[model samples]
Target chain A: MSKYAELFATESRDHLTAMEHALLELESAPADRSALDALFRSVHTLKGMGGAMGYGTVSTLSHAMESLLDRVRSGQESLTPPSIETLLQATDALASAVAASTTGRESALDISTLLTRLAVPAAPAQGTTRVLQIVLDPGTPLPGARAQLIVGRLARVAEIVRVEPDVAGMESAQFTGEFTVQLRSAEAIEVLGDAARAAGFVSSLVEVVPRDEVRQTPLSVDATWNTGDLQAPLQKYVRIESRRLDGLMDLVGELVTMRDRLQVVASRHGDPALDEAVAKAGRLIGELQDGVIGSRLVPVWQVFDRFPRVVREAARAAGKEAVLVVEGREIELDRSLLEQVADPLVHLLRNAVDHGIEPADARVRGGKAVEGRVLLMARRERNSVVVVVADDGRGVDRQRVLAKARRLGWVTDDTEMLSDDEVLRIIARPGFSTAEQVSEVSGRGVGIDAVLAKVRGLGGAVEFSSVEGKGTVFQLRLPVTLAIIPAIIAQVGAESYALPLTHISETVQPAAGALRRVQGRPVFVLRGQVLPLYSLRALVGAAGRDPEGQQIVIVEATDRRAAVLVDRLVGQQDIVVKSFDLVRGMSAGFSGAAILPDGTAALILDAGGLL
Target chain B: MSRQLLVVSVAETLYALPSELVREITTLPSQVTRLPGAEPSIRGLINVRGQLFPVMDLCHRLRGVPGNEAVDVLVVVSDGKTLGLLVDDVRDVIPMDEPAASVTAPDEADTSVVRGVGHSGEMVVIELDVPKLVRSSLA
Candidate 1:
C-alpha cells in the first residue's frame, strides 16, 4: 500500500459521509445551494486525494459523478429524483472503491451504465438563421443543380441550415428555381446575395430576408465586466490570517454603509466639496473591498510551480525523460480551492510520466523526441478557469478499454469504436482496472476518476481528447463564481434587495420620456445602448410604501443585460454572505437570502436569472 | 405511559401537539416579509433571533378560513426543518393516557392531518401529525 493510502482513506470516508448527508438534504430541498455546494466540495476533495494516493478507480468514478453535479450547479441541467437515486448508488460504489483502493486495487464493481447515466449531452449550436428566396430566369437549365452549387458556394461563409424540398427534391425533375434555403450565419446579407448569385444563374433578386429578428430593433445591452489582470508584485502582504481578514472585511462593510448614508446627507446639503469627498470615499471603499477579497485568493503559480519537481521524480521512477511546461501562472483562485486542486494535479502529472510517456527505447522506435512534454496551463474563460494538463505521449488504449467495458456490460456487443469522451467514461468506471494486468498495460487509467469527480464538485468539468499513439489532453475547467463581494441594495416595494455589484454596469434615474415604449414593451436607451426595462412593482407585486424616486439598475449576465426599476437606490454595501439553506419558495429570480445590517432578511437577486 | 400535549387554538378550535415535538412558543410579530409565489396559507416569513422561519397559518391551512392574523406562533421541528405554526393562543399543556388519547374520534369524518381526537370529560383536543402537516402544506 502507498504511504498516503491510510490518510487518504480516512479523509475520504469522512467526505463520503458528508456527501451523503448533503445528498439527503438535497432530496428534501432540491434548490438548496449550500447543500449542493457542500456536496460538490466533498466530491472534489475526495477526487483530489484519491488521485494523489494513486487510486485510479476511485478517481475515475468520482469524475463521472462530478460531471452530473457540475451541470446541475451551472443551471445546464437539473437534479431529478432518478438522477438523485443514481447519485446515491454512485456514493455507495465510491465508498467501496475507497475501501478497495486502500489496498492498491480497483473495486470489483461494474458501474459503467451508472456512469453513462450521469453524462450530460452537449448543447446544440445557436446561430441567427435567415431565409433566402432565389428566383432564377424561367429558362435557366439545370436549376436544381445550380441551386445545389450555390448552396455549396455559400457553405464557405455560412452554415447551410436547410434547403426547401430537400436535396433529393432539388435534384428532381419537378424542382423549381424558387426553392428557399435557410442559412444560419454571421455574414452580411449582401455577402450572402453575392455568394448565391456567384453560381452564375439568372436570378430576380438575391436578397436573404432574415428570419424572426426584423420586427424589433436590436439591443446591445450586454455590459461585460472586465476583472483587470493582477498588477505588479507589490507589497500586498506575504501572508495574513483569513479570520483577521474576515474581521477587517466586516469593519469595511460597516464603513461602506456609513459612506452610503453620508452620500445621502452630503447630496442633500448641496455642497459640492462634501459631495465630492463622499463620492471619493465610496470609490475608495469599493477598491479596498476588492483588494482585500482578491488578497484572499492566491495565484495559481503558488501551487503550480511545485508540479515540475513532482514530474521530475515521477519521470525518474518510470525510467523516462519528461519536461514539464507551465503557463497562465497568474490566474487566481480561492486559496482553499487551489489547495484542493493541487493533489489531483500532482497525480495527473505523475500519471503522465509513469504511464503516458514511453520508455527511452520505445520513444526512439516511435520516431518521437527523447523527452516527453507535459503542459500545465490555466486560462480564464468567461466564468471559469480552465486548467489544461496535456502530454505528448502514447494516448489511452481505446480498444482495450472498450473490450473491458463490453465484458462488464457497460456497452453492448454491437459497440465497435469509442470517441475520446467515451474512452474517458469507460476508463472512469470503478471496475475498469479490476482485471489486474489489463490496466497495468493499457496506460493512463490510474487516479483519473477521482480527479474528474473533484473538478465536477467545484462546478467545473473535464474535457478529454486523444489520438492513438500520439498523445492525450485533459482540460479541468472550474467555475470562478463569486463567494463574497460588495452588493447594491435597492429598495423595491417594501423590501430591500441585494444585487451583486459586479453584475451591475451602472444605475441611472432616467429622464422623463427616456423610458420609451417599443412594441408596447418598456425600453431605455442609455448612451446608445438599448436595454429592456423591468418594473420591480410588476415583477415582485409587493405594495409600495409611498414612492420617493425611481432608479434603474442595469444588471448584466453573459450576453444579456436589462434595466430593473426599483423604488429607489439604497446605496452600496459590502455584504458578508453566509452559506444559508435555499428558501425554495423565495421565487425564481432570487439566488439566496442575506440578513441586512438593520436585521431584516433580503433576497439576493441572481443576475443570470434576472436577465 | 402518559402522553403530554400542548393545546392551542386555531380559529377557536382546540388542537393538541405532542409536547416533545414543540421547540418553543413565541408571539407572532405583526410584520412578515411576503415570500413571493408561496402558497396562500403561508403568512410570509419572520426573522426570530436572526434565523428566518416561514410562518404557516393554521387557521387558513386547516379550516380554509382565509386572512386571519394569528396571535401566537408555535415553533416546531419536523425532520430537522423548523417552521412557525401560527395559532390564536396556547391554552395549556395537559397529560392523558398514552394509547387511549391517541384513538380516532368515533364521530370524526375525515383524517387528513388529524392523528386522533382525544377527550377528557367534556374537553376535547384534536392531535395532529406534525410531519404529515409539514409535508402536506408547507411544500
Candidate 2:
C-alpha cells in the first residue's frame, strides 16, 4: 500500500475510537447535543476519508450513519439504546474496513445488518431550510462563472430552494466573489459541503443556520452568519503515527548515551570550553528526552472508556445490576503500557462483575443495596501508577477459598491461618479458582493467574484486599514506563548486576549472628522477621563464597519479601534497558542487559525471579 | 552479485561471516563482564561505542579446541541485535564471484553452524550461518 493509504488507516482508527467514545456518551445522555454534534462530525469526516481512499464499504456505511445522525441532530428522531448499539456496531465494521484497506484487500465484512439499521427514514420536509454561505477564492479568474458552477453543484446534492441575488442575476455575472446559496435538503450538512467542494474554486463552507435551529428563530434569508467555528476537534493537535514516535524515542535514547560518553571524556580532559559545551549538550539532551517520552503518554481514559460497556454486558449476562464508576481517567501513562494493560484491566473488571457481584435478589437478602457498584480508579504514586478495581458487593468468602486451596493440595493441613498474602498467592496459582461452576464471562480457572503473569511481565504488581461482607479491591501497581528505570547496581561475584529499585526495600549490612537456618534453607532475621535469604552467587551459578561485610538487599515481589545477598552495593542510577534474544540453553534468571556509566554491561536482575 | 566475507579462525577451524553482517573488528577489550548464568558458549558481554552486546566464544560454539592466545572480536548484526563473536585470529577478507551452494556436512553440529562450504582455491572456508548461530546462542 502507498504511504498515504497507511496514514489513512492509522488516522481512521483514531477517529473510530473517538466515535465509539462519543456514541457511548450519547447512550448515557441522550439529550447531549454537543456529543451528538461530535458524533456526527466524526462519522462525517470518516465518510470523506474513506471515500477519498476508495474504501466504498466504509464510506457507504458511514454515510448511512451520518444520515441517521442528521435526523437525530435536527430533533426529528431520538437516540434509543438499540440505535446506539447499531451505531457502535457500524463503527466496528468501519474499523475492520480500515484495517483491510491498509493490507490492500477489499473489505468483505457484510455490514448490511448495520446499514439497514442506520437507514432511518428522514422526516418529511416541513419548510425548515439551511442557508449555506459559500465563498469563492478571490484569485479565481472568473468569479461569476465559479459561483454558477458551485450553484449547479449544490443543486445536484440539494434543492436550490432559495438563491440570494436571484438566479437570473447570477447568470448575468453581476455578483461579487461570494454568494449565499440557501439549501433545503434532508441530507446532513457534510453531504452538501462535499458537493460544494466538488465544484471548483470554493474556499470556505459555513453552515450559517441548520434547518431545525433556524426554525426556532426567523432571520432574514439574506443575513448570513459564519458557523465555521463549530467544526469538531478544532484542529488543535497533529496526528502522528506511533511508530514514528517510537523511532524518535529511540534516537533520543541514543543521544542520551552519546551525551554520557561526552561528559566522561570532558571530565578527563579538564578543558573549560569542552566542559561548557558538554554541559549544555547534557541539559538539552535531558529536555529532549523528556519531551519525546512525554509525547508517548496518553490519557488512561482511552482504556477506561471501554469498561462501562463491558460492565453492562457482563452484568446483564450474570443476572445482576452493576454500575461502573471510573475515576482518575485523565491520568496519563505510556501509550504502549496502556495498550498492554487494557486487557488485564478488562479481565479484572469482568471478574468483579461475574464473581464478586451478587444477583439483585441475593443482594437484598444479604442486607445490601440492590445495585452493585464497581469503582475503577487510577492514581499516581511515586514512580508507579496504582489502578484499583473495587466492588461493593459479595466479598470473597475466605472459608471457601481455603477449602479450595486444601482441595487443590496447594497447602497442607499444617498450614496456619492463611494471611491475605498467602490467599493471593494461592489465587494466583494457575487453575486455582474458587468458582463452583465455570461462567462464560470469566472464572474458568484461567483468569487471575494470567493477570498476575501479565502484570509481572510488565514490571508491575497486583494485590487484592477482601472483607467477608464489605467488598474486594484489586490494586495493580505499575511502573510509569519501561524504557528507562532507576536500578541499584550490585556485585554478585566479580560481575555487576542491576536490580530495579522499584522492588528493593533497603540494603542492610547483616551481622554474622543474624543468619539462621529454617528447614535446611538459609534465612536471615531482619527486624525480627525471618526473611528467606538467597545468595546471588549461588543463584547465578558463580564460584567462591561471598566476602565479609556482605549486604542483604531486601526486595519485594507480588506478596513475598526476600533478601538477596551481594558482595557490595553500587550506587543507584537511571539506566536504559536493552532487550536481547535469549538463546535456548540460557537461563531465564536475568531480565535483560543495561549499560553502566563506565561503559560496561550489567545484567539487570529480574526482581521477581530473585524471589 | 559478488559478496565479501570476513574470514576468521577459531582454534584450527576456518570460518567466514558475511562482511555486511560484521559491523567492526577490534582487539579483545580488557574488561569483558562475565554473565555467570549465561550459556557456556557465551563468553561474556563487551561494550562497543556505549552499546553492550553478548560476545559468543566461537571456539566453544563450533565445538573446537579452546585457544589460549589473544582473540579478536567480530561485532556483527543478527536478528536486529548486535553480537560480538570471539575468534582466535582474523584472516584476510576475500570476494566470491557467486553464491556458494551448501555441501553435505559430516555431522549435524557442523551443518548447524556452517551455511555452506566455500573453497578459496585449495583452502576450505566454512561460511557461517549468522542468523542460525545467533538464534541458537540466544536459545
TM-score of each: 0.44, 0.68
* Residue range A194-276, candidate 1, lDDT tens digits: 88788878475433324245334221211111112111112222336778866676566556555655776787899888888
What candidate 2 gets wrong by more than 4 Å, as runs, is A1-235, A255-285, A443-445, B1-7, B17-29, B48-52, B67-83, B88-111, B115-121
- The residue pairs found clashing in candidate 2 are A582-B138, A583-B138, A583-B139, A584-B138, A584-B139, A585-B139
User: What is the CAPRI rating of model 1's predicted complex?
Assistant: incorrect
lDDT by residue for model 2 (A437-475), tens: 888888665678888878877788888888877888899
Count of clashes in candidate 1: 9
TM-score of 1: 0.44
Q: How does residue A398 of candidate 1 score in lDDT?
A: 82
The lDDT values for all models are: 0.72, 0.78
